[model samples]
Target: MAGAETTRDPYAGKSPAAPLWTADFRFFFTARTTSLLGDAMLPVAITAAVLHAGYGASGVGYALAALVAPFAALIIFGGVLSDRFGARLLMVVSDAARLVFQLVLALLFLLGTPALWQILALLALVGAGSAVFQPGVASVTPRVARDVQKANATLRVSESVTLVLGPSLAGLLLAVSSPAAVVALDALTYGVSGVCLLLLRAVPMGPGPERDGAPSFRADLVEGWREFTARTWLWSVIVVFMLWQLAGAGPATTLGNSTLVTDYGSSTFGLVMSAFGAGSVLGGLVAIRLRPRYPLRAGALSMTVWALMPLGVALGLAAPLVAVCYGISGVGGAFWIVMFHTSVQTHVPQEVLGRVHAYDAAGSLVMKPVGQAAAGPLAGVAGTVPLLFVSSAMAVVTCVLLLALPAVRGLTRAER
Candidate 1:
């Protein structure tokens, strides 16, 4: 049903954004933006809350770990769950649950119970919501776009826009009230997202087994694992990213946050992130217009720009260099994501798309906790500058390693 022509496939030539404005894309795009904006608020808010509670680097590290650990543990299961239930309904429920979780934090703050432990718990719960929502959206993309590339570009653009808007808005909001206000606003965004998700018509999930048999949890894990390992590029990229996440992207953002925002005393951490988002928006728009010759190789090559980010920070080129590095990384990351996603969607069978995507999420996220866990102590010993340089070098190494994998390097665009 995925590539097959049917009533679901529109015969008339139309731009991708057209459907997004009219139907499935509009609802999902709104939902995606709202959720992303809220998510962008989380790190800044969490860091502020921890500082307010008089917690040191260790406490902040733990808080960050709590936010990502669940994705490592539950993302594969999240995919399986989305497949078992309806993706649309699951998405709606996840958004609503997240709203409840954010509201809990707001209430806690209002009650003066803004302890580090409570913040940690709230972050974990919010992470769980992310675990569910991401796979749901990934699983449903085939149902919306006529072309895989269009679908990939559309989703990336929507995400990039949200990333840009979320943190910028969060920064401004943080100036006016306590971090709790950001959480409350996050809750409202989720509520609005839930409402929009509820209004969408039925989304058809492609063929799979009747699912008459209830598999054990371990069995489901094994099944997802088998599905994951079978793909050469998928698992290969996962392996590279394991090192990459552990060594690079994770610490660069989280630990670097402490250095840039806390130590440097810049009120522009959110703005820096927004610059990254802006670059992503540019990349997405470029992806929409420019078809790549070698998506896999190009993606990896684009990621080399990440090496410059740490160099900028290490040199203390905060305003100008940070902005430049972020814009480059954003563009590169956006293109990389589109290539990665389009490859998966085009190559993987739709029946197992959700589970496979879950597998990807689970594997990629597994290192997030490792990085988060190690960031604080490591930064404490290594100092932020050394870690920044080391992480940047590691990212370059990882990108090079990705190029060595035939599955990734040989990948090209699918026939439209």
Candidate 2:
């Protein structure tokens, strides 16, 4: 009944003053934020575990890749399942699965030595769960919130807060105890998130549209593809981001970490990261209040700031200067994400939203591993500073190219 009521009048009983005041939204937001806190701990915990196992740097890479590769491979399938079963159901299942996996991981770390293979296997399972969980959240958000823009902005704000605080919390835990302790806490968060999902009743599970007979997975996949390709603006942005992810992600992760940590030390690198996180939070707050007439165009334009990060590295700027650049870049990054998600939710049909989002995510992330793998070798050959400059220039070019597309420039926010 609540689901039907929401379908009929999405804005009913919604308070503009406090979007999260609604019981359903409050529950959903709390679950998501709590899950994010645990997620923030994962990278640190996994890396520490691998290194502790005496596997060294390559082991760390393999372990991280094991987690990411499965998500990248299975995200589209997860989207299809989400669309078929309903976002809430898929999310609940995902949360439960992750809870089990994390608990096992925690147990292994606490009770006995976790072989590197065992760690990789369990991490991959968590990644697969995330592949399902992400699209579910994306599809469900618009259904739960009356003010889509504010809801999205609020979601970004949550992520920004987690980004700022999660690592610090993880570090503090690491300092006092073992990575296993940190992981056990992550498992506890997953349990809490699962409980929150179990308590959520505002959304219901169901299949998408069916034709003359029962729904065929292949047919559904075809329909999703058609929906995705039908929009020039959507596909174009996806393409740009694929390249953007490739060029920007590798250099920032590999070169940025290596260079900054080498020259300025780990503390300075942490300060820069904190500045970036602060800027991201500020950007989300700004987006909450500022309504751009043409959200896509504004978002595209704002993304140019990303180039500043690589430029700072390329120029061999002082730590403070580099931190300033990262802060500006972080603002742009947050603005882009909120605007882009809002735009997609506004334009895409609800039935196929999960699949489309999955496709978009897959395309955007598929190249990340490639970038990560290549960054080291490329940096060795081309030099980190010069490669960073190229990456920076490429980011600018990608944004400009996207802005030049008529579809991208002309698209406006959907009318409520």
Candidate 3:
């Protein structure tokens, strides 16, 4: 699966460009890109809608939490369903449901500031669709694309581009039109994604558990858990990332705004974020052409670069220096993601890939909210610079420890 596709692996020995020309890959990529754009814009639209309705920061928090809660809770089940029904089918169904929910949410805005509860409910439904769709997206690559790394690079590029453009575009639309109009545009993008998903030809990555005496849901779940736990290299990295999110990323995200505004005479937050996007674009492009022998080793090393961002801020570096750190970190982040995802797809058995991925995704996210929520209180007690320093140290320590595992450091592309 890694060196070259074998006969048993569905599509075999296809060149990197092979996926680009294939109808299936093209359709799937288009579906994902459009959906990503909608998601990128969704936060801005939701914020504008809530604020225009005379709500405060607390309301925005509720809306964001409503969207995040369901996805975090249900994503593991999403993996189960992906393995059961197949990736293509699950993606299509997820898209369709999300489309309906987004459309309804958009319409509600047209009714003169719809109730906060109504908006939150619709956003929750959309989040559930996302929970289901994510597993399918990860598992579907080997089925349609010839080169998994290249495919992942393409997706990363799309995500980075949308991150840079979506908010700016949303702001422009708000200036020229209503908040409901911006939301309607978000719904339209979902429609485009749904159509693309419907047009895709179904391809099963592995056999379903529907044969005689097949496993029940509980049994399947247990099997998936076993597969996840059995991999030392996998779980070890998951643990490291959990700590990285809890200590490094969480504080960086929550405290960054205050740092820029207070430390610098003005807010350069937007400028630094733009630098991250730019660096991510470069990283995705680099990923498309670079293939390493030891992906985990390289990916883990790349992640350590992220420690610089927190370190730079804690030291009260100039805006330009902090921006440079963010840019480099973004590049490292992209490399880590593509390498990690490609490694997972190539190493894990196709039958249980969805379930394993579910565990991986869920575990990585479980600590993030805790970290974000605790950051404020922790900063109040420990002081901002000290907390940021701790964040920076945690990242470097965790990543270094993760690489100490022989299984991780020695993982090669050709291994099963």
lDDT of 1 by residue, 308-404 (tens): 7776787788576787887888888888888888778767755457778998877787787678669888988988888889888986898889999
Please give the ranking of all candidate structures by lDDT, highest first, separated by commas: 3, 2, 1
Q: Write the per-residue lDDT of candidate 2 for residues 308-367, one digit (tens) a residue.
A: 988897798999999999999889888988888888887887767888899988988887
lDDT at 339 for candidate 3?
A: 88
- Candidate 2 minimal-lDDT segment of 10 residues: 1-10
lDDT of 3 by residue, 1-416 (tens): 11132225446555555645478888888888888888888999999989988888889999999999999999999998787767667877788788788888878888888888998999999999899989887777777776788888888988999998888888889999888889889888877887887776646433344322547888778888888888888898898889888988899877765787777644488788888898898889888888899988888788778887788888988889988998998898898898888888878876678888999999999999998889989999988888888888876787688688899888887422
What TM-score number comes out for model 3? Answer: 0.93
Clashes in each model (backbone N, CA, C under 3 Å)?
0, 0, 0
**Candidate 1, run of 10 with poorest lDDT:** 2-11
| Residue pairs with backbone atoms closer than 3 Å in model 2 (clashes) | none
Q: Which whole-number lDDT from 0 to 100 does residue 336 have in model 3?
A: 86
Better of 1 and 2 by lDDT: 2
